[model samples]
Target: MTRKIFKQFFLALVALLSVTFALTTLATADTSNLAAENVDITFGTTVDADLPAGSLLKLNQPAGAIYPLHNSTGKLLSRGIAGDASTAPSLTTDQIKLDVQSGNVYYQVLPDCWLQSDSTVTLLDSTGQAPTDPVALTLKFVDANGKEIQDAKTFDAQFSTTTDATTLATLETELLAIRPAVTGYNLVSADQAEHVITYHYAKPTISTGSTTVATQPSDPVTTTTPIPAKTEPVAVKGTAIYATKKIGLYTSPNFSKATRKIWYQKKQRQNRPQFVVIGYAKSRSGQLRYKIRDINHHSLTNNRRGYITANATYVTSLYYHQNPKKIQVISGHGLNAYQAVTLHGRKLHHYRKGATLEVKAVKTHGLTTRLVLSNGHYITANKTMVIKR
Candidate 1:
């Protein structure tokens, strides 16, 4: 009985050990599949490819040839042993060379992605060691077949140590201070190849203050003073005479017994008598008679009663007494040869030169002269030369 129990216990221990080993193998297999190995594919030194873990890449084979890319755990990254010439297996020639000629590389996080840098990118590890995890990367190039190439990978291994929190904060503050600069971030890409235009809003400002000034008032209104009007002086009434001869001022009428007398004698016979007036008068027949005053009288007798020259007497007053000694005569130029005779206190005389002088015997036609006497007698004289006083 002891021998039989020992055999059964042995078998049971063996079975338990076998089951634990299988389970361990299965877990190890799963863990190994989770960590895929990196694959290096080189078309040429100029042609480069980068493959990350947990990704699928495609490769195209030459006609009638087959190739495969696999991880360290024997999982196929690309499949197809050999393909038809018309549809050969293809490998992506797309790759990007970082720090090709220069030592700096730049990239921008696309929209909906997280950024790892500000303006620069640097290759470094989190623990200050070489990079251990595979990085998801993309390259831009044209293949030998002129086909556009890109990496087919998904990973979270891309990192950069150049991102500065202080710089980002400072940039954000400066951008906010810029009136319209924040909108430009949407306009340019990391490569500065893309642009997005947008509008910005702003506000206006103004200043207000006070000032002092000097001013003056206006002048008062003026009033005009009125002036008194002047009156014209009154004119007095008087007489103005326009005379043609030497007129006299007399004190009486009737020249025979006048207080003063004026006579034309000697050389005065050629001049017109004083107060000579040419006008019309009323005759005895009551008709208009044209008359001349201060005319030369003829001496036909020793009396003043002699025939008046036709149309020679005017009825207006003759002023002959103002200058008594002023004589006037028509001929025989002397005053002493004439006589003065009075007829009842009226002078009536004529010129006489050795002839009998009588009122009834006076001749009507003869050479005569007029002599003005100091006794107020105007007599006619014959053959006598009158003197002027």
Candidate 2:
């Protein structure tokens, strides 16, 4: 069983491990082109937990022909001849027929698709704290094209402590959990039940009336890239602005980017993460990003390293509020922005009230509504009637 990828979804019943399985480790089974058999696949958990004794798993809708591995008697091993330790997988006759297509021969051994039922999920912030609302909410299987396959499957029973069944009902025979909260990340795989599959190709020897000749192995016409590479969370460090101690920082100059955390405070020596920036990155439209770092870093292999992108983490200053941009006209009178965030500092611009302008991002300080103008200027958003920047 290879490591399955688990998108930061909260699931206490099963853990998705995106473990990269080494293909070189498995010894190839002998191939017989004339009589290759297909192993049937089914699904069930080996864990002897408190699940209902006979609850079944099914998909919300039929997207593809998916069968989970069974867990009744024991794990069905790959099939082979004597001295061949591989156990044969159980498959329906229909799948076996499909396996023997016009250009390929199927094998009797199927990949492992065992489902364990002991893990639970908890959505954690980068700081290891749960969000005010549940963060990791959606979980499902997807095709390699990044489209969801089906709705969450259900069981015959409504699972509550008092419901007829206490076991989980899953759909698609797929084994991947997804969290859509994270931006710019997607879970894409055509893999079935999240199992790594291997196929044995066999070329038959045609015995003509008076000739004996060998043919090349059949081409794999229907094979597909079934698994996505693991994506580890990254740690970023940012420099603080304003020598006074801390200022807002962001992953990028984009106002919509998230604010990075200040992991440590030298003066306090506590784990309190303050939203602050360390330094600035390149700016565009007068918007700049603050460099930031992850407080705790995960150890990685494959010569892996972590990075914060213009889209991932950032500093949150008054100039870099976490809001999307909007263009509007300064519509009211006596409206303006203050440099000190209070109603007391000099204005960054002298735009007349009711003037049309583009508001890049917004931040509210006390009674002031600061706005970043399209011409690289600042003003209060109070009078703006977005005219589309």
Candidate 3:
């Protein structure tokens, strides 16, 4: 019996030792999986990585390829590699660009992909020199009528005769950044040219005039006809007119009352109240009134038909009535070309500032005129937007 007990105890001891050995092997395997392998990386020696762990970098990539650029904190930043347009780096290229830094900065090509001393990264100086032909830039502040309100400010140091797109765009951005504030005058337009920038401001206008209504009268009211006082016509049919002072728009030729009115507001740079003469209506006192249709877009009284004063002092012809032999876009912002005379549909094209376009024809649409272009597009005939060249 003692011999049997001894054998059982010996078997139990062997089983425990076997279990402990298996547990020790599993613990050693877990430790090996958790540790990171040491890698020797050299960035400048070669373009391609030789190690099995290092990422494979391609050589002779085109310029402007999107790369996985990283910041100091390993944050990814997308940037294009530098090169010429014809030979620029393609989008799929694995090339990267590094800006010269002051201290030790890390440039990560990809996740866990790095070049320490094995790859050669070339850096180029990108700073451009200033142009030698610098010119004086004049900023003219004018009122709504193109009359100067303040002395012209000249910045001789801020401008150069650089024709590059980046230089011109930077110059314009700097010009607007330093604009002086003028109290009691709201800026209307900033017309920019090669050397001159004209800023139009509208002064606060306080005038004494008859109050006008917004909506038109449903029915025309008859009034007693007075004896004739004046007989000569102020303007004939199809004449374009603009208000010099506040004016009322009457439903009829007679001065019964103004169903609607136009205020003397020229705050907008290109937009002003203008109309085309349809016919004439003689008031009771025989005062000639211009029967008109509103053509100023975005105006509350746009497209309305009424009779207005024909006094040359109050209403006058637009700058030009006929199509110019040649026209150029003068507005700082480019003008839109339309498919039709009326600006009702989507714009057909946009002509940038300083573009010269040939005029094909001019037609009267809603009293205002539209210039048909040589390219079969329509643009506004307003003098403020385009200049006769």
Q: Which candidate is the best by TM-score?
A: 3
- Least accurate stretch of 10 residues (summed lDDT) in model 1? 232-241
Task: Name the weakest run of 10 consecutive residues (lDDT summed) in model 3.
Answer: 34-43
Off by over 4 Å in 3: 1-241, 244-246, 250-262, 266-269, 276-279, 293-297, 302-306, 316-320, 330-333, 338-348, 353-369, 372-378
C-alpha RMSD for every candidate: 73.5, 25.7, 30.7
Error of 1 at 213 (Å): 99
Write the residue-wise lDDT of candidate 2 on 172-264 in tens digits: 111221111111222233233222211212233568889975554444222211222245221122211111123333323343425332212
In candidate 1, what are the lDDT values of residues 74-145, reduced to their tens digit? 334432223223431121111111110011122111111111212122233222233344223222222234
- Whole-model lDDT, candidate 1? 0.25
Better of 1 and 3 by TM-score: 3
Off by over 4 Å in 2: 1-330, 337-346, 350-352, 358-375, 379-384
Q: Comparing candidate 1 with candidate 2, which one achieves the higher TM-score?
A: 2
Best by lDDT: 3
TM-score per prediction, in order, is 0.13, 0.18, 0.30
Count of clashing pairs, candidate 3? 16
Q: Once model 2 is optimally superposed onto the true structure by TM-score, how far is the C-alpha of residue 77 displaced, in angstroms?
A: 52
Off by over 4 Å in 1: 1-319, 323-332, 335-389
Predict model 2's lDDT versus the native: 0.28
